[model samples]
Each structure stands twice: as C-alpha cells, then as structure tokens.
Target: MVKRLGLFVIGFSLIVVIIQVAIPSADGRFEQADATPEKRPFLIVAGLDSLTNGALTHKTKSRYLDTLIPQMHKTYGDGGPGYVPFDSIYFKQDHHQLKMSRRLKEINDLEPGQYPSQYSFDLKGLYTNKGRSDWLRFDLKKDWTYGRVFYLQQPDGGSFKIGYRHQKFIQVDTGGSLSLKTIELPKHVQDRQVVIRHISGKVTLFGGIFLKNGGVAVSRIGQGGDLLRWHAQLNNAFMKQWLQQLKPDLLIFNGGTNDRYRSSVGEFRRHLRHYLKPFEASKCQILINAPNAVKYKQKRLLNFIHSMKAYAKQHNDAFISNQKVLGNTFQEAQQAGYMGDWVHPNHRGTKKIGNQLFFYIREHVLPSYKKEHAGF
Candidate 1:
C-alpha cells in the first residue's frame, strides 16, 4: 500500500511539472525566466566626419555623423556602436540622408569633457552662426531619472537659454571661457526635449551629455582641422587625467586629413609615436584609422597608408583604412556619387564608410574579444 501511494504521488508531481512547462504566463506569453543581462563593450571614435564644417555641403544639405551612428548599431547589434536614442533638433534639412524634419529617437554617444587639455573636440559644439537663433538641442530617450551637461567656452563666454520645446526652463550665464558646467535636470521635466540656445557670448564646445540610464558612454572627441600630432600638444597631466577618467576600453584615432600631406613616411611615424605616448599607458586597446584618400598626392598617400598599417602591425593594434575601404582615389569615389568634395564624403559615402567599419570590427575585433571575454 505504501509503494502504491508513493507511485501515485510521483505521478501527480510529474503531471504538475509538465503542466507548468506547457503553460504560458499571466499575459499569455512564454518568457525566459533565467535570461542573463547583456554586457556591452565601450567604444570611443575620435576624428572628423562628413559634416565637419560642412565640407561637402550643397544647398546647405550635408552629411552628418548622426546618419552613421544608427547604421553601426544595426550592423553589429550591441557589440557595434551600442548607441542609444536621445531627443534633439537635427538640422535634417542640412543633411542628405534626412529628407524631412522629423521627431524620432536617434542614437548619440554622450560627449565627455577633459579640462586644460586644450582640445575641445567633443561632438557638441557651438559654431559662430548668424541665423534665426543658434541653439543646441537634446531629447531624452528614456524617462529621465538624472542627467549632466558639460561645455567649454571660447575666450568669449556667453549665456544660454534652456527650455523644452516651446517652454522656457532656465537661463544661465557661462561666466567665462575654458570653463565647465554641470547641471542637473528636474524629474518633473524628464523625458522631454531640452534646447539650449546661445543668448549671449561664445560657447565653443558642449562636452558631456550623460544619462543615469544609457548604453555604452562613447564620447565623440572629433574636431575639424585636427591631427593626431595636435593631441600631443595637450598638457601631459591634463591628457593623462582626462583619459584616466574616460576609462575607455577602446580608442580609435580617426585623424590625418588635416596634416597627412605635410609629413613624409619617417616624419609621420615619428608624429604617431609622440602623439600616441599619452594614450599608450592607458589599458584601452588603440586602433589607428587611415585618412581618407585625397585627390592630390596619390603615390605619396599610398606610401603613408602603408606606413600606418606597418605601425599598427608593429604595435599589435588594429588599423582600418578609410582610404582603401572608401575609395582608392577621390575620382573613384566621385564616380560612385560618394564624394561630395575633394576629400570629405557625401551621404552615400558616409554610409559606405560606416558599413565598412561595421564589417571590419565584426571580422577582426569582435571575434578575439568574444573568445577572451566570452561575449560583449
């Protein structure tokens, strides 16, 4: 009798287990209860993009990095750029990829600031413009819990009027040049579009845009008229301090166009060594991005590119060739309607560059990282 009773209980328990596995949740959905959280690798890209100073702008329409950011995410998933959306005014009319002014979520790497570094290359900057009103905009992607904004002023400081859409939020004077501002947003106005218009004075750069809840905080430290050698001019202490604060897992130096023509092979290598010294001590993996192909100096350009590749091999670091991937020459890229000007890329051109970068990272960088770290 005891054996029979035990058998009945075991059968009942089996039936219960089967039912539980087959049944759906309260809302009629199957869910993975033991799913692990995703881990994202931080990636920072520094250099010039198509829209820098409107190099290829036609009828005010130009190519912007914003167009490329989303493509990076789509191609590589989380392991790609790992971008998150935020609300901000996009000069969509000024860009080729964007056909109309629309309000939609777009990925933006929260910019970061390094003081006394002498380079305000952050993605957000206030250029001198005479128009309706000069403004910097931000739209929160998620329900905002907390946020921070950092900016570097020019020798001529200015005041900023902050607001959301059509409402006036607050106004603050930047006080002076080469300064930083850390402002906290109120929860009542969370998840709304924030606009900062230059009321008076000159604010050259808007450095940091950090959200309490966001994806990989990759800062866009790109600047127009900038070269790798220019970075070496920064105060050593400031450079070290700033890089330490960023704690970048990956650092990509996408520079050369502004200064490549002036340097010979040996000189270029020397410039790289001196420029890279500040970043060498950092634990971050450094990747060197080749300059875009120029119309002038074809043979010399190829030699320079070869030298860059050789340097990457010597250091056991990654080197991506924008010139080879984009085009062998400006004429070739122009034939494909990718070149808007002699050097910078058009909207289609920028897309191509972004795609190539996506594939290159997938083919070279991610596999090794995954093998060592399990996943990212």
Candidate 2:
C-alpha cells in the first residue's frame, strides 16, 4: 500500500511539472516596430509650441494633431479607435506655458554626479576630416527618458562644448502640449573671426537634423553670431536614458519657425553646425519643416516660407510646408475652429500638420527607404 501511494505521488508531480513547462513567461513584453504593408511610415513633428501648434477649435480643444493624425490614419487604414501612438494623449504638452528663461536656469542647476542614468549614450562612427568633422553616428539608447545636456566637439580641434554639463540644462516653455526642451549653445568663441565652436545644452526634440553644407542656423537672444544654430540638445539625465533605450531607427528634424525668433541668425547657424555635426555622423535624415504663414502680416510669413523652401531644395533634405496649405492657412485654420491664438493652430491643426508630413514622408521618403533597406 505504501509503495502504491508513492507511485501515485510521483505521477502527479510529473503532470504538474509538465503543466508548468507548457506555460509561457509572464514578463515577456516587447512589440516590434516593423513596417507594415498597410501602414505608412512615421512622421515626427518637433518644435510644437502654442503659436506653431496651430489654432484651437471653438467647441472642443481639437487642434491640428488631433484632427490630422486620425485623418491620415484613416486614409491609410492604420490607426482607429483604441489605437494611438506614443501611448500618450493625442494633443498634450504645450511649450507656451513654461517659463523658459526662469525655469531654464532652475533646471540648469542640477548636478551631473547627482544623475548618471540620465547620461547613458552611445557614440558611433566618430571621425574627422579636412578642418571639418563628420559626426557620423551616435545613438541615445535608453537615455531619452531623462532630460540631459548635449555637446558637439569640432573636427580638427576646437572648444565651446555646450550641453547639460554634468548638472545644468535649459528649460523650454512647452505650454503643456509640446515634448521638447530648449538647449541653447554656449557663446561663440572668437578665433580668427567670430567662430561658433560649440553648441551644447539640454533638449529632447527628436527626429531633428543638422545642415548639409554648414547650412543650418540658430537664433538665441544675444549669441552675437548672425546665422542660426542647430537645436539638438541631450535631454535631462533620465530623459536621455529613455531616448537611448527607445533607440530610434531614424531621427528627423522639423524646425524653421522658432528659428525666426532669434536675435542673430548668423551665429545661431554657425553654432547649429556644431550640434548637427554629431547627427551627420549618424547619416540621419534631418527633416526641416519650413515656416508656415501666420495671421496679420501674411506676406512676411510667406517670404520666410519661400526662403525655407529654397533651403530644402538646395540641401535636398526633407521639408514640410504648412505654409502652402492654403486652406490650412492662418485665416482658414482659425476659421476651421482650430486656432489657439490666431497664430498657432490647436490640436486639430497639429494633427493636420502631422498628417500632411506623414503623407509626404510615406509618398516621398519611405519608398526610397524601402528600396535601400531591401524591401523592409
């Protein structure tokens, strides 16, 4: 009888072990970002503040992003109910509400040693050339979560390294709708002439790109330089870690609206080259969204858009024209009940902007990407 009981217990234990072996692990969760035949490519829109986000709608807070993303998603038959990117609100984080000047200083007060996880990054394809550098490639694996500082060193030797230097960083007024921080570069170094040797600081506006032939520009309040600088800062400590962890396949850039708000375009651009130097190393495609028309003085805005159009043509970088969307113009956009302040479009307008850019990327950019990546 005792031997029979022992045999039964052994048999039951074997069945339990088998059941356990058949069950899958409970902690395995990582969805792939594969390109779908039905879905179009992604279009990342950076620098979305109040004025640039388009106007707000009259009834709901429906802005451009809200309207345009769904419209494009429907047109492509990808996004629908219960399906949204970023796992975040369609229209959230506006830069207009923050105190950029004051809060920026406060953020700059952090200590580098106080945060190491915020500084994890990978520098790839680092090289130099004739009196110039090609910051071939680098990756912010999981470092995007923590807003850290960034710096750009020159080829052939130079200084002016600016970024979230171990502790300090810039703070942007996102108005609670945007997801980027401003990281202004250091003052230009006076060598033979007024040279912008470095552009360092804290920022998190991904998919931004550098210029082709020293073509970028930046405009800080009193940077002394004339041209504009590239606006690519390393994020806060942990913020950078998130970016590093996310590991974007491509990082596009969309700016030119905020570039107009600079004190000097020359020095800004000079310093921008420094910021872009790292991106160029990565061979990342930097998309530059040209300035669109705002209300009041239409011609001036139109002229700037034209200039940006020319810049895109000359450089052959990606360019989206919110200015050309005549129906989506400032007047039409406001009338569409999507203006936040008659200058910037609201959520619906931002979605529209995102949709337009998304289509452009799908139609014009991704086909080449497919061919290049062997039908990926």
Candidate 3:
C-alpha cells in the first residue's frame, strides 16, 4: 500500500511540474524598455578650450548638462525613474559599421578643473543680450525644478519676468515667482522642441525662466578658447584626473573661432596644433569645427576658418566644415537686428543661436552617428 501510494504521489508531482512549465508568467511586459541587449563600454571627450565654451555665457546663471547622468542608471539601474534616455534627440539609423575611430585622449594623468569639459568647467563671461525684451522658449517650461536665469531691464524700466509654458515649485536665483503684472505664460504647455516669436509682434511677450534639472545631459564647451589656450596650462595634471572621471563619449573641438581671430597664419595653426597633441591622446573623435568668422576686430574670421577647414580635409581623417550653419545664423542675425553688438547675440540672439546649434547637432550631426556599432 505504501509503495502504491508513493507511485501515485510521484505521478501527480510529475503532472504538476508539466503544467507549470507550459504556463507563462502573469506579467505582460515581454521586453525591457531601457535596452538594446548590449551597451557601449565608455566614451571620452577630448580637446576642450574656453572659446570652445561660449565666449560670454554667464556661468552663474547657466546650468551644465550631464550627458552621462542618464546613462548612469543603464549600468546600475537605480537612478530615479529609470536608465538615462540617450533621448535619441537624433540617433535613428537602420545600418552602420564601427569604423576605427581616429580620436585621441588628452590628460591621462592630471587633476580636476584642469580639463575644459569637466563638470566644474564654466564659461568666461555671460555672453548675453541686454536691453532686449524678446525671449525664445527652448523645451516647454514644464516640471522645471531649478536652474540659473537672466533678463533685461526693458525699455520702459519695468522688471522683465521670464515666462514659462508650464511649471511648479520652480525657483530662480532667489526663489521668487515672476511678476504677473507684466509677463504671461500658459499653465501647462508641452512642446517637444523649442519655438519663439517677437514680443513686439505680440505686445505681451512670454517671460523666460532658465530652470535646473538632473538627468543625462551634455553641453557644447562654449567659446572661451580666446583666453583659455593663452591662459589655461593645457596639460596640467589636474585636467587629466577630471577626464578620467567624466569619460565623455565625445569631446567636440568647437573652436578655430578664436584661432581665426588670429594675428597671423602661424599663430592660428600653432594653437590649433598645440591642442591636437594632447587631444590625440584622449581617445575621442576629434571634430575640428572651424569658426564662421564674423568681422571680429574688423577681421573676416569666416575666411580664415575656411582656410583651416581645407587644411583639415587634406588629412582625410575626421574634420568637417560647420561654417555654413554658423554663417546662415549670422546672416539671420544681421537681418533680424538681433546682432545688436555686431558680435555676441542678445537675448533674442542667444535663443536663436542656441536653437540653431542644438538643431544642427540634432539633425545633421546625430543622424551621421549611430547609437550602436553593428559591424564592429
């Protein structure tokens, strides 16, 4: 009887095991949202200088974007809501091959604040417009938690209250709400991209409030190379240590503007080559962006940049001309009168330039780069 009972139990258990294997789990999510199955190891940003940073951006009022902040979660999977979204603001391609990159790493052994792309690195001055009332909206100003801000004094002398499409608990320099008497903004607006128009065109221009947020973010090292290459000790050890920590996927050499504002051809190429040596060691694709020379100091900078571009192409490595876009914006600036100083943009100018730069990278630059290297 015991043997018979044991046999029955064994058969029943076998049936139960079979039933479980045939049934699927209760949760319906079959694919992971934050993934492509595999991930890249690391990226390094090389060759950063001051003008490479905006020449006159106010550091006190601007927030730097951490491109890695979003990616951090992908590796650890524990940052806020989830992994950092490469956001693909532009990366969309069905096919690509991993070509051997010709980039290099700089400052392998240095200290912090020494590197231009470091989190601590900031612009030289606030290159912003004054006496201008118009403001351009970047991303819809909803859910803005915190960030730096700037404004104009208005022709009539009333305080300019920066406006937002939608927001809450968002604070500026001193944690104060904007004056409702002058500015007007929607309570909850959501714009996938930035858009703007003249307040003179509307009489009631929307106020702008630059807010701060935390996520995977990145910023172009603005234009500061003017004083930086001349002042920054280039390869000081502090700069190298910073690179080790930040390890950016790409470091853009958005310079040659200051270089083009040169006294002679030798001086221009000298500085350009000086940066290249250390940069070659950084292991990042070096994009030698030439400056679309404006009449800086009465110098036709665009022409000089054009010459350097030809030189870059001679090597057949990796350098492209961005002068066209820069030139177009400059022409637009001239037509709009936003080039108030005939140089740096005013509030209206900054927004337009910023959006233009952002879009160029999004549309032109990002498409050429695939998020993954399939053939490698």
Alpha-carbon local distance difference test for all models: 0.45, 0.31, 0.30
By lDDT, the best candidate is: 1
Query: How many clashing pairs does model 1 include?
Result: 3
Residue 302 miss distance in model 3 (angstroms): 3.4
- The 10 consecutive residues of candidate 1 with the worst lDDT sum are 7-16
TM-score of 3: 0.39
List CA RMSD, all candidates.
Answer: 19.3, 22.6, 24.8
lDDT of 2 by residue, 334-366 (tens): 776555554455555556666776677568765
Q: Over 4 Å off in model 2, which ranges?
A: 1-45, 48-252, 265-277, 296-307, 327-329, 332-338, 373-376
Per-candidate TM equals 0.57, 0.41, 0.39
Question: On lDDT, who's better, 2 or 3?
Answer: 2
Candidate 3's C-alpha runs over 4 A off are 1-216, 219-225, 236-245, 256-263, 298-300, 314-323, 326-332, 347-356, 363-376
For residue 373, give model 2's deviation from the true position in Å.
4.1
- lDDT for 119 in candidate 2 is 25
- Please report how far candidate 1 places residue 128 from its true position, in Å: 16
Q: How accurate locally is residue 321 in candidate 1, as Cα lDDT from 0 to 100?
A: 72
Give the candidate order by descending TM-score. 1, 2, 3
Candidate 3 worst ten-residue window by lDDT: 7-16
